[model samples]
Target: MDNRTNLDDYLAGLGISDAEESAPLPPAPDTTAAPLPDAANESPKAVLERFLRGLIARIDPELSVTVRETEEALEAEISGENAARLAGRDGRTLGAIEVIAYTVLAKQEGRGDLRVRVDVGGFRRRQADTLTKLAERLAIGVAKSGEPHELQPMPAAERRVIHIALKEHPDVMSESVGEGAARRLIIRPRHS
Candidate 1:
């Protein structure tokens, strides 16, 4: 009855002094033959999505995540309130998130080849549209003046948009110049 009951006294008091009154031992867990838990069996895509959601929740719990697969990569899009700001000015924050996603994919349990692309509120898509329009406008100017024009150095993704925009053009051709961050595209009147 006291706070610290003696084991022998308690056992005797409970009338459990005989073997039949004692409780049976529970079965031991099967450590070696046990299969993984359901969560551990989740696909790589599911795991990545869960991680992305948790990460974005830190920024704002109201933000929603949508993940899909393309032949080239897993595209994860984040939306809702200040999502563009979350991407940061000129998508610097989004780029960092992308690097983090790729790092996650690299360290995943299975399949090291999967690629991750993190976009915030269609920022990358809109930027691609803007770059494509710029490419088209520049191509027109180059055709008229028969002058070569070089665009300011840009990221490879933006550069690819420019190149593709002018791919079928009659008068201009695009080529990348310089090295590393200094690399840029040159749009010039193609010579026969």
Candidate 2:
């Protein structure tokens, strides 16, 4: 008739009790647990968009950026009176921003090689296309004259575009030479 129970006796009684009553309540079955996120469907483009959103949120709370994915990479287009500030001198700022954005997205997606391109007012795309055409023209000239044509020194990315554009050329050969700031592409006639 006495319902009073000591703490040690209560614990011992539970231990001695059958599993149906004392087995620590079986953990409640976890019905309200959150579903795992669908990272499998996530792409480099989505990560890039999220990264740019974060950057804009921190740097320019009032400014908005639009992101698009081309066939090869992610591109972000931003506009504002301070857009030039983001673009920097000859787009150096934009390029630096791009490196940071790519790093962020790569880390988020567990990727080491994510490609991201940040541009202001379509400058980079225009520059790349124009440089590609120039390379093609120079390659044609070198092919016709059978003499090596030296081009102005360019950054690694531009040089890479030139090389890739001329990769299929049957009449000319493209080679990058020199050191540091002096490096340039030399287009010459292919061997007969």
Candidate 3:
């Protein structure tokens, strides 16, 4: 299928792998770089960007798309007035978009996994900051009170932020409990 066809056709850039793990993205788009020999001589990043541009145009003309090839994965940052709306509450909507993007794009014949990541209105960054601080505060409280604190159920990405935030914490540790959508992070005082 032609990627540039429409939003529904190209919203598969953010699908997760079998292990439900995040793939590495790219750095930045090089304007003068030679194009890959794809359907239109465009690289994966180029194709994804073109597809996102068309998607954004349909959603909100004021919004803009910037696709960067990080050393990790293809990062698409959407920004503008209506960006927060697309971001959804706590980035749930953006997560949905990312999942669809990855699943769809990865299944495109020889595409394999495109390693695409999306952030709407910088929601990922801001949410990471908030989650990190919350984790730290809860960890401290758990350590002092000798009690465990179970936070609200969160998605894998959000739970990852909390785990990583307290990875080296001296007094507390983090763990995820429950299953599927009910999975949540728990902070507890270190046993030792």
Candidate 4:
């Protein structure tokens, strides 16, 4: 029994006629979705500052702010307990605020796709140091054993730090994998 005959026998067992099995199907409809806009050109930091400002305005019209744009990002200080509300659960509130700010800024700036880092109460800074150390430790382990090591999931800024810090090490390579909240970094020996 040839392969086609075996397939026919299998389909016949399922009670489908040859005509039905051979029926012409419409070409897989081109379901290609639109591509997302690029994020590199988006000013993620400035948008975050605007969001913080909006939150501050709602909390207290008298509140003032200080906005500082760094070469890599932006920072804003609301200067009171109002900042506490934005801080939210484990800085999650700050993360949400930052995302909203980025979305608004990206759209208003005609950028549909850009990521911005937002931090409140120095949360991201501390996280950077921690991620850097973890990356360094894994770099050593990977260099010694030549086995890939996957770290826990982290937000974008932390992942950036890991990528930057390990990028200079000649013996190791790091890249992010996974998606959404589960996204993480895998450090491994670069191919020779």
TM-score of 4: 0.60
Residues 28-71, model 2: lDDT tens digits: 12333232224346576755664465455456655567888778
Q: How many steric clashes between backbone atoms does each model show? A: 0, 0, 22, 2
Per-residue error (Å), model 2, residue 161: 2.3
Tens-digit per-residue lDDT, 18-104, candidate 1:
222332222123322222224345666765675576467556767778999889888899998878788897899899888766655
Q: Taking the tens digit of each residue's C-alpha lDDT, what string does model 4 give over 1-192?
A: 597566445333322224233232222224332222233343455334434544555555555556677665555665554545556777777776666555555544666555455555566677788878988888888999989998889887778899999998988999999999999999989864
- Best-matching candidate per lDDT: 1
lDDT of 1: 0.73
The predicted structure with the larger lDDT, 3 or 4, is 3
Error (Å) of candidate 3 at residue 76 is 1.1
Cα miss at 168, model 4 (Å)? 0.2
Q: How do all models score by TM-score?
A: 0.74, 0.62, 0.73, 0.60
RMSD of 4: 19.0
Q: Which stretches of candidate 3 lie over 4 Å from their true place?
A: 1-37, 109-114
TM-score, predicted candidate 3 vs. hidden true structure: 0.73
Candidate 1, residue 64: how far the Cα is off, in Å: 0.6
- lDDT tens readout by residue for model 3, 33-131: 232233334566765665566456667777878889988788999999889799777677888778765655554425665687899888889889998
Pick by TM-score: which candidate is best? 1
Position 146, candidate 2: lDDT: 85
